[model samples]
Target: MKRISSIFCVALIGCLLQGCEKKIDLELKTTTPIIVVDGRVTNSSSEGSVVALSYTKTVKSDNSIVPLTGATVTIQEGNGTVYSLPEVSNGVYRNASLTGIVGKTYHLTVVANGQTLTSSSTMPTMVAFDSLVAEDFPGFGKTIKVVTPFYNDPPGYGNQYNLSIIKNGKLIKDVFAYDDLFIDGKKATFPLIYSRKADEFKKGDLIEVVMNCIDHANYKYWFSFSQSSTGSPQAVPDNPISNINGRAIGVFGAVTFQKRSIVIQ
Candidate 1:
């Protein structure tokens, strides 16, 4: 098992990048319907987890972190236990004594003004690596369309991921997926893509891919990060969800969400 992991996903963007119009019609202002509070835990270990909460910027506004000054955040454990989390800092809640143990269930709730938002699921055991294979797209082998396939044991959510291409143990290129997305009101985890970034990888090299997943807020931030990253677009798979199990619920981040992970293949 690798010491760390990463998740891959996409976010719903409002404003256009480079002033180019894209998804401009899908605008959800603060007064529209819901407020999405993305809470994903990345950089975690047996020691502790540092989770983050983020939101898509207000439509037509610059990319800025929304101030969650008075918002109340709470986490619920399995067996219907509840604990209120004080804001450790801006948009962050730290449970110094709380550690994410595999197999135990957890739920998060954030209340602001007169609104309440919640989601929950159990954590999965850590996943091990598979392999990263590089192949050229049909009719485009030595040129334009080179495809890199990253596979891992238990090819699904809750498992962590990161990609590394090494030359003589020297770092060549690495990619990490931010696997936090609202699929049917649950948190989803997936793999990352990094073929186009490095110009020096081939079929005989050791190319490793990393993967993992976190909460919705972390998912959205990573989604935005990927969109704003300086490279070609790599899209992550979205989970199937209902109104009750969505990340972006009524006037909140999302409604229905499954935090658990499973094997895909």
Candidate 2:
């Protein structure tokens, strides 16, 4: 697996921007094909377990990314409840009824293109999101408005978090992971800074903030992604630390999330 791991170190532009457009140029000297696995299960009743499978693009490939099809995907609960996810489209598998439960662990298994990949994650209890406070920060010779969320961290060590900002229903493209290294069981607040200056919200815009209580493995994945997304030309890009065990690249996360919204003033 170590030899396979070194051949597919992807310098991801920004994992935070799931819906944003990106262009990657690979200069690696390898001919081995890679399988990418991305799976997630959330606590929301309206959400479901979604796993997307795809092949890594190479310099010899065309502009479009190729998806891996006809794969078997299954998720098992710690209590031995197994749910099969059917392919809904090209390479995406989903089971809408499989809502994640807090404190329960989940195992993901995927068999595709002659490779077997698996991972496990436990959903953490949600931390209450109290309020969204908008404030101004002096930067680049001007005052920039930003939204900060206030929450009380639960009284336990190793509480990690993944935050997402949505403006007028569209997701913001930036990394927002947090940990209780300094403020465990205490009041916590931080501004949701935008990577691009034009992404800042204006007055009258509707803003929604989501906080996902995640395990340490998922937290490290997001934190590593945040580091690799520096947008610096001089920085050599590498793949984020994945929880999945196999000859694959990506993550499988079981998370419980809470959300709050506010209208920019």
Candidate 3:
């Protein structure tokens, strides 16, 4: 989740800002390599689906990731339609014509190094927001404009949402997810959190907020990921609860998205 990444980035920036000259050596423990898969299928016909493959490294390594190549990846629809994704470059497997439809289940299969990994997710219905507005929040040294999106929760249980904020065509490093546990079948006004540098929106900047209707499994994946990544005291420092089987780390998400944009005034 973006929240987890944002927290890590803030901590790293703080350490750099401290201007410490002393180099501290840490005895990093070596661990076995695990396959990381970030695969997604959306309802947008113009957008292609991709499955990125890579191997994790130790903390003491040179911080370079080795891409997993020559792998076979395929996605199967619930109606028995299977599409194969070929390796293009940079360890990425993509299929340009495979578009997900709402209320349909999608299954992902990967074969690499004699190992097979698979996961399934169902695409939920798309929920469009009613409106979007920018609200000014007075801070210590600056005024921050937080984007607020308004939407009505559909009359049903098990509804989950994921908000993605884009500034000037670039996605911001902050994850926003919500569930209608208490406010089911009600109008919801969710405000975006802007606590870090990467989350701040400026005047005259183009901002787009994308709301995704995700299933319960995808919601749990992201919620647990955000908690574990942020080093929450309640959560143990381990890999987020993965939906993928066969020791792979990452998620296979099938989502429906509705987006709206506004230029900051």
Candidate 4:
């Protein structure tokens, strides 16, 4: 019986050793997305003061931004001041319309699940608009190539234009669609980017763009209409776009897209 007991102990030790070796062979690590919070205090910001927060996307695929369902963001200012931002939407936080002054120091804190993070940037002297301009977006094998220069789009609040593409009063459909660009300079030309599309228009398609200013909120309303994929143009009927005349606090680069009808070599 004693000999049998010894054999049983040896079997148990062998099993324990094998389990330890398997665990030693296994290796694991993790990578967590970085969370970012940006706060801006502008002099003439319509909403007063606001905060925009974002998170890192998936490294391999373009569609991966983790949702901010239960994230909490808070801002604290100098002089022992603390403010709670309202979660306007998923991951978007807004602050009360407080006039932000120059030289005031502010900091932001973010907490999601158990992870915590922080970031801060002082508000620079505010810059106002000169006017938003739309010009021909060159490059990217656009319609008529570089020879056809895009002109300044007239000012309007919304996206409708009382304009015509006339080469000698003949209406031409040179305008393809809106395309935004991030120039090498890294500034978002921040314009309603557009360009002539290949095949959509002919060579030397003389096109003219015209529009008057509508409302400051026209772009947002029009975008929603576009997303619905409505075949018709009127996105928001109430904000009927009329005159296309206005200037911008700054210039905007136009957007462009490749005309599928025209094939490239």
| Runs of candidate 1 exceeding 4 Å displacement | 1-34, 41-51, 54-61, 129-210, 213-265
lDDT of each: 0.39, 0.73, 0.73, 0.34
| lDDT tens per residue, model 1, 1-265 | 0112222232232222213211122243543432434353322543233234445444333434454556777776677656666777876665655555556667767766666656654555554333333453433245332324333344344332223333434543333333422232233323223454344444455443324433333333333333332221111112212111233421111111112212121
lDDT of 4 by residue, 1-265 (tens): 2124223433444365443211111011213443333344433344445555444332222324444656676666655577777788876677656545554555556666676555333343222212323244444554222222223333321122112233334534322222111121122223232233432334544444332221212222232223332212311112221111121010111111111111111
Instruction: Return the candidate ranking by lDDT, descending.
Output: 2, 3, 1, 4
- Residue-level error in angstroms, candidate 2, position 145: 2.0
Per-candidate TM-scores read: 0.45, 0.80, 0.79, 0.40
Query: Alpha carbon lDDT of residue 55, candidate 1?
Result: 51
Least accurate 10 contiguous residues by lDDT in model 2? 2-11
Better of 1 and 2 by lDDT: 2
Q: Cα lDDT for residue 28, model 4?
A: 18
**Candidate 3: Cα lDDT at 3:** 46
- Checking candidate 3 for backbone clashes, the offending pairs are none
